[model samples]
Target: MKFLRTALGSAAVSHPAIDLQTSFTAAAQAAGLIKAGQQFDPFANENNFLLGAFIFEDVGVTAYKGAAPLITNKTYLEAAAGILAVEAYHAGTIRSALFTKGLATPANAISKARDSLDGPTDLDQSISRDGSMVNVTPTDANGIAFSRSPGQVLNVVYLTPKKATKGGFFPAGVNGDVKTSAGR
Candidate 1:
């Protein structure tokens, strides 16, 4: 929560409809991902934290893509590209870590949970199948990893295919234009 507080600060940001620090904590608690009065433990919170990191990266990628056309400044565009690269790195690192840990069973369970919440979607890749470990990375035709759109990302976070305003990972809803629905 301290990280959230520092990143989002006390002032309300117009983009994320609610205060990110407050909404994120409330949503995580509401979803039982984190217990009230519990100390933050990275190892204990791995699943949730990874899920959050995935969502964060996806949102950033989508946001950057959406804003690209409107950005007339070259410097801003370059900065956005750098930021996106970092987000991609974060996502890839999480995916690799999960795979390396042989977390197939738990990853699949989490995938199923997400699918149920966001509705059935091909976008949700299970880390394992047929009793074997498998890669869960989203890839393009060349087998290269790809970024997800905001909506696709939300579908994973909300754990449902249906367009949701709020639920699952975000109880109150994310701030800005993203909200709980898929991004355009």
Candidate 2:
């Protein structure tokens, strides 16, 4: 975020920034993910918290990778690639931790939930092991990571398969033209 802010500040284009004061959507609150006044807890519990982290990191990696081809600026693309690498590393570490602690079932559940939100096609994978082989990286048969469109990504965050401008994480909606989530 700081990097983008700095880059934009140095450039001619002045894109509107994300609203930092945004609250969790009604759906999230009703689901008891967080209390009315409490902040989103990163350390809510051992398993649940790590599950959140796992989801976050994995999404970060895929989102970055998905956006790579759309980047026209070489410098920005390089920076994004660096960020993607870091996100991938973070995701791998989280997956390894979850596997070591035997949280594959819950992790897979979250993956399935995300998959359902994204689209009809099942692109998500389970964090599982085959005998002694641990499955850390979730990929296709060709070993390619899956990509989600902007709307698809929004669907997951918005917690809906229906087209929506607001719900789930962004109660007041995102602050740009691409605020709508795709209806699966």
Minimum summed lDDT over a 10-residue window in model 1 is located at: 11-20
Displacement of residue 48 (Cα, Å) in model 1 is: 6.5
Candidate 1 residue lDDT tens string, 52-170 = 45434544544565556655767656766666667667756776666676655554555554444433444445555675555545555777444455666666455456788765456
Q: Candidate 2 residues 11-56, lDDT tens each?
A: 4244433322232222234334446875544455776567767656
Per lDDT, the best of the predicted structures is: 2
TM accuracy, model 1 = 0.54
Candidate 1 runs further than 4 Å off: 1-12, 15-76, 115-121, 128-137, 158-160, 178-184
lDDT of each: 0.54, 0.69
